[model samples]
Target: MLPEEGVNAVRVVVGMLVRGEYEELETLTEARRLTAAEIAAAVRRHGRDLISPPDEAFRELGGVAVPREQADERAFHVDFPLWTAQDGLSDLTLGLTVAEVMDGVWTVELDGVHAP
Candidate 1:
C-alpha cells in the first residue's frame, strides 16, 4: 500500500496517463521526469554494471495505467520505484522504471530503471 502522499501522486499521474500525457514521475525523495528510454539506459549503465546488479533487491513498487492509443484496445502504463538495494549510498535513485502492467501487476520485461 502507498502512503497518503504517494496515493495522491498516483492519482494525478494516473489521470494524466489516461489522457495520453506522459511526463516526469515524482516520488517521496526524488523529483524528476524520465522517459522510458532514458530510464532504461541509466539502469543498464549504473545499476547493472557498477552499483547494484539485477537481483531480488530490485523490485517493483507500483504501477499506473496509461492508454496506448485511442483506437487500440490494448493496455499500457509505467511503474515507478524499481527499488534496487544499494551498498552505502541512498537507494532512492535506484528505484525508477517505466513498466507495462500485466496480470494485474507490472511486467519486468517492459520495465526500466535508473541509478544516481
Candidate 2:
C-alpha cells in the first residue's frame, strides 16, 4: 500500500485535472507555482477536459492508488502508477512522481505526470 497522504495528494491533483482546474495545480506543486508555458504544455499534452466528473465525484473516484514502487516516507522521491480517470481504471495508468518536501509531505513535481 502507498502512504495515505501521498495517495490523497494524487487524488486532488487528478481531480483538478479532471475538472480542468489548471490554476489550482500550482498550489499542489513543489515549486508552489507553474508558469503559463508549463500549464499550456500540460494542456496540450494531456488535453483539456480529459475527464469531467462532478465535484463530489472526487470523493468516490479511484480507490487509493497503490504505488508500483515508492521510497520510504522520509525519502524525497515517491513515484507511482495512478489511473487518470474513472473510465480508464481498468487499463490506463499515468506515471506520477512526487517530491517529499518534508517527511510525509509529497508535492507533485513538474513532469510528474506521464504514461507508465
Give the lDDT of residue 4 in candidate 1. 33
Enumerate residue pairs that collide in model 2: none
- Candidate 1 lDDT (Cα, whole model)? 0.36
lDDT of 2 at 67: 43
RMSD of each predicted structure: 12.7, 6.4
Report, for every candidate in turn, its global Cα lDDT versus the true structure.
0.36, 0.49
RMSD in angstroms between candidate 2 and the native structure over all alpha carbons: 6.4
Clash count, predicted structure 1: 1
lDDT of 1 by residue, 1-116 (tens): 23333334344443332232333332311333556445445545654323322333223334454454444332333344332335433343432223323333322222334333
Pairs of colliding residues, candidate 1: 24-33
Off by over 4 Å in 1: 1-44, 47-61, 70-76, 83-85, 88-111
Candidate 2: deviation at residue 33, Å?
9.0
Candidate 2 — which residues are off by over 4 angstroms? 30-36, 46-48, 52-94, 112-116
